[model samples]
Target chain A: MSDSLFENLRLELRRGCLTLAVLANLRTERYGYTLRKALEEAGLEMDEGTLYPLLRRLEGQGLLASEWREENKRRKRFYRLTPDGERMFDHLAAELQRINASLERIIAEAHA
Target chain B: MTTLFERYLHAVGEALPKDVVAADVTAEIADDLHSRAEEREAELGRELTDEEAAAILREYGDPRVVAARYGRVQSLIGPELLPYYWSTLTLALVVVVALELVVGGISAIVRADGLRFFSALDVAVHSLVWVFTIVTVIFAAAERVPQGRQRLARVMRWDPRALAAPSALPPVARSSSLAEFIANTLALLVLLDARGAHRVPLDRLVATMLSDLHLTLTVAWQPALVGTAVGAALVAIAAMIAFLRPQAAVVHEMLRMLGSVVAIVGLAMTLASGPLFDPGGGIATTIGYVTLGAAIAVLAVQAVLSVRALLVRAPMPTPKSARG
Candidate 1:
């Protein structure tokens, strides 16, 4: 595949996983900068504009709660998943697993 | 330190809404660009200049597009509303045109023999009526279209924050005001000429009115002229007010009321004066009076519809508890 085409497919895949990734990472409380770096380390690059708004939206929708706290002499807003978010995340994770298994089966059959 | 990367980020930041373009986002993007440039430089075993980093940032699509991707939902008007808009517009235009024709035909029949007496005045009034009908119908039709509504909505969404910031008035309002001014001036001149002569011939009447008035010493004509001017000015002002404040609803209603009043007065003056103040004989004059009455009726109906549409309130959104 062309690099550009592959990049687009990768972005499409990442788009679905963004909410999941944010929830998974927020299983522990983390600030915007730390969460961004962690996601990049896991090979999922997100820009600040995309991430911050998603955080705000998720919080608005009651999936996440956030508060500004003093950390290392700097004011940082940290986010964490609510109980509702945790239940939603588990449902999503199960659905993702099923999708992954189906995809893997298709790929294995194609190779065989 | 100020760098090309920082400047690029700033350019993008300026394009975004203030709340979206926070200092944190700016700093993070700036850092990413700097790190990427440094990494590329180290890998190549050479120094990457600020200019080279700037070029890379430019190759990435414009900052506005990048920022927009975060949460910019599509803004298209839904397809379902298009048919409603088109049907309503076509129906309204047909009704208005039909009304104009009916009134025009009645007047023509009534003044059939008196044509000679009021020929100039008849032509002028007919032309003015035609022009007003065409212009208003066009405006009403345009307003019903989805794109027109969107354009109107944008104009209406005035932020006091934006008011202090430099922005030009929307082009639609500006152009409409200019057109209204010109139309009013022309209408005033024609109406004044029509009123000035009692029963003179067309050519002689115009010549006499112009020659006697000489354009400069036309102060005596100011009352009628100013009345028409004021009416036109009100309509134009009302349109701008409607454009800026569609939610108010009353502004549009007021415009419709004011327009009806002007039309009524103009029609009454035209009919009562009898083709430029020369009273005609027989059924022709009676027909002219009836035609004037029909025009008044049409205006009255339009005023009622405008008021009804404006005053009818939409049902309030049900509360969450009620929804359950």
Candidate 2:
């Protein structure tokens, strides 16, 4: 009901989904700003400030593989999802779809 | 001019760990800033000024706020330990206050000098400061230990079966009207004979010891004490009658009258009683105005109950829809 409380709860709900989204997009090589822009295109507005830190955390967790190479006359660390990340993503995607379908059914039954 | 881009990177670098890794981290951020500035210039079809770069950096937020995301989470005491911290502080404060009261009471009784107000207060303050400081330091240190949060969290884990079944509980009584009857009666007896305690008085021994400590009040209000006691008695009687004869309008008026007497007794006590001779000898106005303040609080609550009892005779407000 309160705006800040609603924001905090919404942030918590989105935390896991953001991680999954980030890992999924890393299936192809992309750098910090590019990954952020890609996520924005998918309708998730991530803070550019947080994007690099999240990238570092995911790489540290072994869910992402990264390397630096020169592009457009500047060097940038590019990231891609690891094999382990791919398997984790498939499992989470299945779980999310199952939950979504169940929730839709519940809403429909309530309306009926 | 130290450009805003340079200033921003310096701040980020300072927040980061002071090691070789810091260099690489700063380099990454500097590269990101340059790329963003170039993109903005391209969009505007011109080179951006230092102020424009500053605005972009400000939108990114404070360096420390952004850097905090990269650091391992740190707190002196986090939410997981907060409940235990509160319980410990509360328990410690209660025990310390109680110990000071007992020790000060004994010292005043033994010393012909009687209880000095400041001495007892000094002990209480010292005890609280020492105990509170020690407990906080211990918890803060414990919070720094590796895996400490997880270890503490595991200790408070919930089990589904541990909670009591709501349906299994015995039903509450329909009303609790007579709950204060016994308490009021005891207070009345104490008020009736403030001097009577000095007769057989183990309490009088304590009182004599207490009085011996030079902790006596400047003026005694014996009549006001008696009035408060009598008011308490009348209030108890009124409450009992109101409950037993809830439908009787006459009885409700009597309860209201009794509530007024209790309030007047409080006013009289406040007028007649003087300041305690030794303010720190713990609850200094033994048989007088100190009791009056407590009696005033009790009267206020009793007054509310009396008002409610009087209103019972009046018809309840009904919705217009119900009438229709």
Candidate 3:
């Protein structure tokens, strides 16, 4: 009914997906801008501001590893999934798939 | 001129925590901004304006909010300590108000002096500010304290059983509950007894209290006296409502406000009598002083309960969901 309410619900729904996407994409080491561009190319557009902080937080939680490395004469922080992060990403992806399957079944039954 | 890119980088760095590597972070941001500006220029086939660069920075949102996303949750008073903070602050402030009133009342009675409005107000304001500041500082420090140390005592353990317990008693309605009916009836009886309307006669009650005091009980005294009676009547009505509809939240809040008004009126009546001391020390003066003390005590309890009521949220019954 309200635009603000819709935006809030959208934000909440995106929060879980964002974490999963970030983890999955960080399997290969990439700097902040490149990771964001990769995600955007795959249809999940993320703000640079939101993604950078998230990378830092995931690194802090020990799920992602990062280091400052110079590339093309400019230094940038590169992030990639750790072994722990890979395991976490697999677990989360499985859980999300289960939830989506239940929703699909319910929708199909309702339509029938 | 400091380039727009440098200024934006500076703003972001300023909001970041001190522990963050400022130089590395700013350098990364500067490169990212350069790429973004180049993209915009390529699309337009021209270099970006200062205003356009400023727009990009604004689009990133408040630097503080952006920076906060990189840190742990920030709050002046964290959720865990909020309830305790309010309780300590409310209790301290209520006690301070009571002590001020008692001291003022007793001083006036002993001196046989009239209670001046401005001076009494001055004392109340000063005491309130002092109590508020001290309580806030202590609780704020508790909230800011890092983990790994016990801020509260060991007695405040996290027990699952506490979750199932009802934190506060429901509000009293006049008709639905027996206990509420009795409580309200008893309070009314106390009001009548204080007036001596049910027993020793009104004049004797008036004469006994008034003769020792240096007050010319005029038509002005009538308002507060009448107000006490009216407040008592409202309390009786509130009790009846409780007896009828114990579930009505709004009505109970209204009754509580009425009760507060009544207590305030009663206090006004005591002040209107001037100093409570009987010039001639006798049985009448002793009775008068005790009665004054009891009245002040009742007002203090009401004030504290009102503060409690304000703090606690009354849960309303939920309506049925559309899905059902």
Q: Pick by lDDT: which candidate is best?
A: 3
Give the per-residue Cα lDDT of candidate 2 at B229: 48
Candidate number that wins on DockQ, 1 or 3? 3
lDDT per residue as tens, model 1, B8-82: 777777766554645655554555555566667889799776677767687655887766644433233234334
lDDT of 2 at A14: 91
Give the runs in model 1 whose Cα sits over 4 Å from its true position: A1-14, A25-56, A59-84, A98-112, B18-21, B44-47, B70-73, B76-324
Q: TM-scores for all candidates?
A: 0.38, 0.59, 0.62
lDDT of 1 by residue, A1-112 (tens): 6999998998888887998999999999998878988999998888766787688778878999887677655566778999998998999999999999999999999999
Clashing pairs in 2: B114-B212, B114-B213, B115-B213, B117-B280
Interface RMSD of each: 5.1, 1.6, 1.7
| Candidate 3 chain B minimal-lDDT segment of 10 residues | B109-118
Please give the RMSD to the true structure for each candidate, in Å.
15.6, 13.6, 10.9
lDDT of 1 at B201: 60
lDDT of 1 at B163: 37
Predicted complex 1: CAPRI docking category: incorrect
Model 3 per-residue lDDT tens digits across residues A7-107: 99999999889999989998999988888889999899899778877887788889999888988777877889999999999999999999999999999
TM of chain B vs. native, candidate 3: 0.49
Clashes of each: 1, 4, 13
- On TM-score, the candidate that comes out on top is 3
True contacts reproduced, candidate 3: 0.55
TM-score ranking from best candidate downward? 3, 2, 1
